[model samples]
Target: MDVLLERKSVRNYTNEDVKQEDLEYILRAAMSAPTARNTRCYSFLVIKNKETHKKIAQIHRAAQMILEAPLAILVVGDEDKAYEKYLPQDCAAATQNILLAATAKGYGSVWCGIYSNEERAKAIEKLFDLPTNIKAFSIVVIGKSTDNRPPKNGWDPEKTKYEKWK
Candidate 1:
C-alpha cells in the first residue's frame, strides 16, 4: 500500500542494470491485470540494449527517457486475438500493472504513450514490423531512480453518483 502511494514516474536512472528476475516479475504483474472478455490479447517486448533503446527513443520523440533507462517495455495489442470493443482497455490495464509493479519493486518507471498519434505510432509499427492488426499502446521505461516522486490518488468525491437519479 505504501509502495502504491509512493510510486512515481522516474525518468533519471542509475548505472546499475535491472535484474532479469525483476523484469520477469514485472511482466508477471502486467499479465495479472484484468482484460475485457479475458481476451488477454496484450503483447509486450522488453528492450534492454542501450543501442536499441537509443534508436527507439530517436524514433519516438516522446520517449526521451528511453535513452537513459536501463530497461524499456513496449506493450502492444495482438490483433490475432483482439476484440474490437475492448482491445484498448486490455492494453491500458496491462500498462498500469507494469507501472505499479515497477514501483513496488523499488524501481521507478514511466509510461509513455505512442499509438495515440498517427505519425509517431506509424514509426513504431515500421521499426518493429508489427502486423496490421497489432496496435502499439504504450512504452514503460524502467530503472533505478535518482529521485522519489509519489503517485497521486486523483479522484473527486463530489463526482459520486446516487442509487437513483442525480
Candidate 2:
C-alpha cells in the first residue's frame, strides 16, 4: 500500500540509467495486472534507441520527456487475442499498471497518450509498421528521478455516482 501511495508522475530525471533487472521486474509486475475476460492480449515495445525515442517525442508535442528519459515503453494491445472496441481501454489499463509499478520501484515515469487522436495513431502505426488491429495507445517514459514531490490522490468522488438509475 505504501508503494501505491508513493507512486507519482515524475518529469525531471537524474543521469543514472535504469537497471535492466529493475525494468524487467516492473514489466513483469505490469503483466501481472488482471485483464478483462483474461484477454491477456498485450504487447510491449521498449524504446531504448535514441533515434526511435526522439521520433516518438515528435508525435507528442508536450512530450519532451521522451528525449530525456532513458526508456519509453510502448504499450499495445494484441488484437490476435483481444476483441475490438475494448482493445484500447484494455491496453490503457495495462499501461497504467506499468506506470504505477515504476513509481513503486523509486523510478520516475510519465504516460504519453498516443491513441487519443487518429492522426497521432496513424503516425505511430506507420512509424512502427504495426498491423491494423494492434493499437499503440500509450507511451510510458521511465527513468531515475532528479526531483521528487508529494504523492497525489485522484479521488474524484463527485465525479462518480451510486445506484440512482434514472
Candidate 3:
C-alpha cells in the first residue's frame, strides 16, 4: 500500500544508468500481471540506446523524459496473440506492474501513453520496425531519480459509488 501511494510519475532522472538485474526484475514483474485468458500477448521493447530514446522523445511530445532516462521500455500489444478487446486492458495492467516494481526497487519511472494516438503509434512502429500486428501501447522510462517527492494520496470519497449510483 505504501508503495502504491508512493508510485508517482518521475520525469527527472540522474545520469546513473539502471542496473541490468533491476531491469530484468521489472520485466519479470510486468510479465506476472494478469492477462485475459492467460494470453500474455505483450512484448517488451527495451530501449537503452541514447539515439533511440531521443527519437522516441521526439515522437511523443509528452515523453521528453525518455531522452533523459537511462532506459525506456515500450509495452507493445499483439492483436493476433491476444483478443483485440482485451489488448488495452492487458497492456495497461502490465505497465502498472512495471511501475510498481520499479518503485519498489527504488527506481524512478514514468508511463507515457502511446496507444490511443495513431501518429505516435506509427512513429513507434517505424522507429522500432515493429510488425503491423504489434502496436505500441505505452512507454515506461526508468532511471535514478534526480528529485525526491513525498507520496500522494488522492482518494476521493465523493468519487466512490456503492453498489448503485446515488
TM-score of each: 0.90, 0.88, 0.95
Tens digit of lDDT per residue, candidate 1, span 1-166? Answer: 6766777778788867889888999999999989877889998999888888877888888788878788999999977787766877899999999999988888889899886777877888888899898888899999999875546766687778789556
Q: Could you arrange the candidates by TM-score from highest to lowest?
A: 3, 1, 2
Cα lDDT, model 3, residue 16: 89
User: Clashing residue pairs in candidate 1, if any?
Assistant: none
Candidate 2: lDDT of 79? 75
Residue 159 C-alpha lDDT in model 2: 73
Clashes of 2: 0
By lDDT, the better pick of 1 and 2 is 1
After superposition, which runs of candidate 1 have C-alpha atoms over 4 Å from their true positions? 153-156, 159-165
Best-to-worst lDDT order:
3, 1, 2
Q: State the lDDT of candidate 2 residue by residue for 1-166, as single tens digits.
A: 5777777777887657888888998799768867778887888988888899888878778678878888888888877787656777788888889988888777989888887778988898889999987877888899998765776887787877788743
What TM-score does structure 2 among the candidates reach? 0.88
By summed lDDT, the worst window of 10 consecutive residues in model 2 runs over: 80-89
List per-candidate RMSD values in Å.
1.8, 2.2, 1.2
Among these predicted structures, which one has the highest TM-score?
Answer: 3
The CA lDDT at 75 in model 1 is 95
